[model samples]
Target chain A: MTSSSLIKSFERVKEDNRAALLTYTVGGDPDKKTSLNIFKSIAESGADIIECGLGHGANIGDGGAIQDSTYRALSGGIKTDDIFEIIEDFKKDYETDVIIMTYQNKIMAYGEEDFIKKCISSKVSGIICVDWPWPLNLDFAKKCKENSIVFIQLLCPTTNEDRLKNILNDAHEVVYYISMLSTTGQKLKVSSDEIKKRFNLIKKISPDKKCIIGFGITADTINDFKDTDACVVGSALCREITRSINEELNPATNVGNMVSDLKQKLSS
Target chain B: MKLEKGIPLIDQHDENGYWGGKFGGNQIAESLNYPIEELTREFEKLRNDETFIAERDYYFKNFVGAPTPFIKLENLTKHLGGAQIYCKLVSKATGGAHKAYNAVVHSLICKRLGKTYIGGDTGAGYAGKMLSMAAAKFNLKCKIFMGTKDVERQSINVFSMRSYGAEVVPVNSGSQTLVDAVSECMRWWTSENEEAHMCVGSTVGPTIFVKICAWSTAQISREMRKQVMDEFGEVPKDMKLINCVGGGSSAAGFWNEWIDYDNIELIGVEAGGPEGSSKHAAPLTNESPIGVLHGATQYVIQDDQGEIEETESISAGLDYPGVSPLHCFLKETGRARYTSASDEEALEAFQLVSKNEGFVSPSLEPSHAFAEAIKIAPKLSKDTIIVVDSCGDSAKDSKIIAERLGYKI
Candidate 1:
């Protein structure tokens, strides 16, 4: 099998001795043209991976900030086909590993096998479905593997040893560890030390697979999880976009500056 | 009253939660898997424990008014001039709805799990009232998530929940109905899983929850089966069980006992919203494509892009865009048939049942079922028997019912 760009991106960041800064933004937040510009800004601002979210109506895993952004995207007329176009447009201008993050219904509605094929053609790197986990995702992940697309598996603090083993056994290139048992955009409920202690346990269980911390990692908390292969800063960036739009500022520039600052925090 | 042994239909699912090798599973966030598995284990243990069974039976008999009367609607059957219409009077249950069955069982489970806090989602607010009542009885704190829209419409139930010292959190998210209420409740459960138990109001969530709720409510069918045997000396030759499908708890409860009896027919009624409108909450009848919603893979009313559609219905309890995965399995296998009743038709049924049967205040949720039964009852022969689960009282629907009836109450 060919090496996935997602794995290569992690390897490149591993050599730098710093976790990759994965910036998340909805595919068509605010609007379509500005969404593409935001993606360009995110990539140019030193984000190793761009987790472009597909706009969904009900984002159970997301908190208010991400949910607002998703609603904005949906109201702005963003669709699955439009999201792919945005990714194709971004891949033309940048080599950032672009993983599509969405709920399960989007992929299921788009046809799972055909969705993987679309990812391959759009130069998308991976997929993170917040609602699909473990045995339910087993088949979809297998199909993704055949097309060299990384299917990211999600784990949480509540995940026990048996389930953890089963999930990692089927995991592909990367695994996402939700820092706490909450929706996105919430402040990290557990201390950084506690998160590290749990993350270390996962790392000990799987030494080779790349792991990332998500759900609670913001600029303030991103550096604390630097031991992981990557950190996904999602709701914070979406919040920045929301704030920028509310304050009549340039969202792309503001989001780009936020990502750059987050990257700087990681290296420091 | 001992718990019935091994419900074959409810237990037919695989270990992973699929029913009939097609629908139902824990299609949830990875964080929820461990807790759901933990719940599955505890529920399994409690199901067989004699003491637990006795405790649950005590609550079912004494508190929830279990063995709710299965009586023939004589006036309606004679008026229809066709099928013998029978009604399982579930509205007679305490808290005025069948939700009390699931709520009492879930609250007992919460106490056994050593959790002091219990939460649930409510649509027309029956679940909230039932859970609050049960939680207060068990000396546990209760919180109910309700859509803001429903909060406005279901004031009576809201006040009852509050009177029980339960907090009603108004959810201001998508559509502000039962679907969003469930979404918000699940999100809250994700954060509070350590200290709280989520009592899902219907059989529409992940596999374990669906199983738990179905198990709790299936007692209705068990009692009805015994009643049928006592009344007719055997199962009726041509019988149809009808119940409304809003996440499909009462229907699951009313039909699970009869799944093995192929001669008995199962019919589900869905909310069809306004007359001649494109929007409705009839996923099973609308031929909605299969997708995952609220942790279960089922038929969902969604657009081309897979976003859940905005559903409408006269009954807040039935204003949902998704149906239970078990119902999906039933629909796929052709073991059960589903149809829908529009708001106008249900309203007409509401009036007819009140006038003919003298049940002055029937809840609109089950009125949808009665609407279908009314439509088909007049067509079948007198030998045919149709049983409709009268699942809720109209206490919470006074405003909607009065306004639709041109009254200012």
Candidate 2:
């Protein structure tokens, strides 16, 4: 997907008065084939944006669930470049926005400009650096902007006013608003009004940027962020994917059904 | 990228990196509720505070035994008939290891910050003991997380920490080792208030802790430099500083002074288990690719699939999957070189040093350093001086040694 298409995704969801569903899955949990099937299922399951995790087991943003999946993927021999392959396959079949969520080392090691170029070529819509703190990554973000790749920024519940102002004023296509300080896979509840209040703050700065809530969100807690532009359900999806693989169930069918259930809940 | 002066107990990001690198930067950034800038600013203020400095100085001089003895190992040097050897007896310091310095400094920081609790991780137990003692002195509650296996193996140290008024919690996470203990500590740090600081065990966490530990540990090099010059009339030209690299706290501390010097050789020895494998901890020697573990970019011993492998060693302290990023930078920049010794070799060094110099190191980590120093000593001329970091006394290792020797502990 191009940069415009990614923005169009949020616009399209807004038109229906239904929030976008941004689902996350790794490149190769058990192996590449299962990952492809999982991506295929996700693409057809009405996801508006796809957040694919890069393979690094030492993901600090995660708890046991996502960490275990990343380890399984890496232990399954998934490489950094393989994530692009999965994204490319998804783009071929679905119009959903594709974003690569990763730590900075993968890009730093690959050279920042080169990484941007590769993402562009892969039809990746945007990227979110989990560790890109405010103001430190402006140059990299600028480089990404120039290349037509959306440099997605993330803000947390605890992000202070000065820091949020600095980040949101020049925010690009999308901003990931973490629902809580806890890592992925924890059980937490966020009220719709509370999320709306946080969203209103970002809305004040850059009315154009897309906002989504992630971390500890699921079907039960979807209402909290369902009014926003998007809601990301990552570790929960990965957990179900792992269960399917471990139980000898069809990963493609299992993932498709799981995502479809969430999408249905969102639209209803 | 702007480079701050190379002082972090006082500064945060330098040209090298913040929170260390791409891998480590985000963990703290994403996890902590407190803004990193505020933490850095307050730390910078405390860096030059005279009250804190005086508190540290008074403890070192009066209570903890500052200026730990630097002695010429005459018998060991005579036995080798090669390089003259010296031992900086850090084992004689408070808590009986080089880790006490950082514990005291961090405890003082905790006090100044008005924190009620101080938490930290331990493997071999020296660092936990130091933190517990410091917390007791500072009137703050202390909690330590150690591996379940370590809690069993180093039971005496567990008892020692408990005796010092700390609550030692056994971590039953991945591998149940030092790396897991660190992970558990980070978990605890997140749940606690921002003011509640954890005594990071080594120079391997976020940039602030790395700088603080290195600065705190630098006391070894500082005291050693002054004493060596006083006794020998000039700095030894071919001086070699050897330290066992677990998380490389001692190496960072020992090498911080001489790192910029061209002639001095700084050697960090890693734990090489049965297969010369990193599956248990010899990253620099095993040449594990650079990855993030606990927020620092260094040689992490992970498999191709990116699963960090558990490290094995006779010394619990030396059995970590990675070392300090500063040590990694040193190895990459040629400021320091890394070597390794297998468990058998380290065990032999442990026995040899105890017999020859009447020194039994509490932790197995320094034995690797001793093993490396023994190999290097014989090839060097008599004028060359090799300084072995005797990091801790082996009283804690008595049970393990007895068990190893087929005696019931």
Candidate 3:
């Protein structure tokens, strides 16, 4: 699918007075079969875009919840190649916009050209390399465009105008603006006004691309995206899945409820 | 060849006809080649520039304590019962090491290249301290990357660096040590070219870096001449200069001024690791061949297929697998003799110096140099004067030695 179509889908969701549910699941988190089922479940439960996290051994940015998930994935013997296999399986059974959020080493290890080709073959819609900067990585940006893969640039609260302009100049598809300084699971104390101001500044620089705010965003924080293109609730949904696992509840049901509640709150 | 005034070390061809021949080209990444080349050319133009020279001289004299005193190791020499030993007290330099000299020069070079941010990788933490001081004095942004292991080990140095306003980025890749820190810094420098310049921590690269370090070493040699004249009334006829070689900075610093002096025998002591093992010895004296690395062609430890081999030594400062190209050339031509001291011998010497002289010389770098002095002193007469470049103090390494030797501090 083209990047334009994916952007259209998000716009349609906004038009329908519903939040774009961007569900995040660790690729091969438990196993390939379990993760594929989770991806299928996410697609069926009205997730507009599925973000599959490729876990690494040294996860500098991951918090406790994701760190445990990564360890479980590794203990279940999930290698990076298993991620592509899981994506291929999900693509065979489901049709939805897919984005791979991962560290740069996995891509470097896979060899850039081969990785792009595999993403293209799997029909992956976009990619967000967490540690890679947009300005310093123009070569990867060029290759991503050549392979018809949308490259998503991340802007944070600390991003200055010069860096923001540089990011926007090379950014494609969408831009994911981190709402705060802390990691995925950490509590964010910054107010909605602050987030909105940061988002507006980024929007001014990247007017052509969709801007989604992520990190510590929950059902209560849904209104934070009143000025944003979309709100991404990742850690909240993942936390619910963790709670369900501890309570012996079905994770699929818990995830479904979490996203549905956040969606309702966003719409209200 | 006539030496020019304020020219630092005189650039003269040796009788053996080697002029940075095999050891001189810093074989860095092709991406860095242009910037380094540009910097080198620009530094050549500015080296003799009055403003640059004035700034250098001022910083050296005031900030770094130029012409650091040369102290004779009379007590230690008498105990050893052979050659009289002296030390070029570089610990007197600001930031307490020889690194200030190289760091100031590189900082100036970066400023001339229009770089506002300076970064480096350090094992001894000397470069980090020096860069921090330079950054504070010059109003440039400075960031230093260190191995996580070194961070845990050198907490004092880390705190010292932060005290001077340098951001220390701890790198936790591949053994989480100096080598990995250097690789990560290279990656960062490549990505952040617009704002950052890598002020390399070693003196093993281009002629300019060597020349700057040589100037620092020349200070040692110049002071030694004065000390000898003050003590004995003339320049000593027979003198042996011994220094440790990691990436070969301190050794090169002392050797640069005396390369043309045929009467002075230059000796370099490398970490032998274990006697028979490659794990403890650095690459140049153990398992290395002719190859280019980090912008210079020199003796490099590489695998059979020519990939760089990772090296380890008890001393973090001596953990690199490549030696200065000039040192490699000197080794090949036999202008300087290279010897290896085992981790055990270095440790013994470390303890001996602390116990006898009340001087705690840290790491295996200084101890290794002293170990070599001990070995060679027995062969020389009592009148022979040997100068050892005491690179760093042992305060940073006391805990490690205490733990390894099972002794309570």
Query: Which candidate achieves the best TM-score against the true structure?
Result: 1
Question: TM-score of model 2's chain A, to 2 decimals?
Answer: 0.95
* Candidate 3 C-alpha lDDT tens digits along B133-177: 888888889999899988887777888889989999997654577
Per-residue lDDT over B1-409 for candidate 1, one digit per residue giving the tens place of the 0 to 100 score: 1112355656767777877665777778887877787899999999999999999999999999888988889998988889999999999999999899899999999999999999999999999999999999999999999999999999999999999999999998778888899999999998889999999999989888888899999999989989999989999999999999989999999998898788899999999999988888999998898888888888999998889998999999998899887788788878889999999999999989989987645799999999999999999999999999999988778788999899996
Residue A165: error of model 2 in Å?
2.6
lDDT of 1 by residue, A1-268 (tens): 2236678888899999999899888999988899999999999999999999996777678888888999899988889988999899988889888989999889889998779878888899889999988887888888888888888899999898887888888888688889899988898889989888878888888889888888788778778877678888989899999999999999999999999999999988
Each candidate's chain A: what TM-score?
A: 0.97, 0.95, 0.93
Q: Native-vs-model 1 lDDT?
A: 0.89
- Chain B TM-score by candidate, in order shown: 0.97, 0.93, 0.89
Model 2 iRMS: 3.5
True contacts kept of each: 0.80, 0.20, 0.00
lDDT per residue (tens digit) for residues B1-409 in model 2: 2212454322334453542233233235454636344555566788688887887788866667889989888888898889998888888898789888998888887777777889999989988988998889888899999999999988888998999999999986667888888877776675454557777898887776777788788888888889888989987788999998989898878776676566889898988875555355778776788766776667888665445677788889888998877776666656678888888787778887887877545357788888898888999999898998888888888888777767885
User: What does the lDDT come to for candidate 3?
Assistant: 0.71
The DockQ-based CAPRI class assigned to model 2 is acceptable
lDDT of 2 by residue, A91-168 (tens): 777777788888765665566777888888788888887755556667888988898888887887778888788788
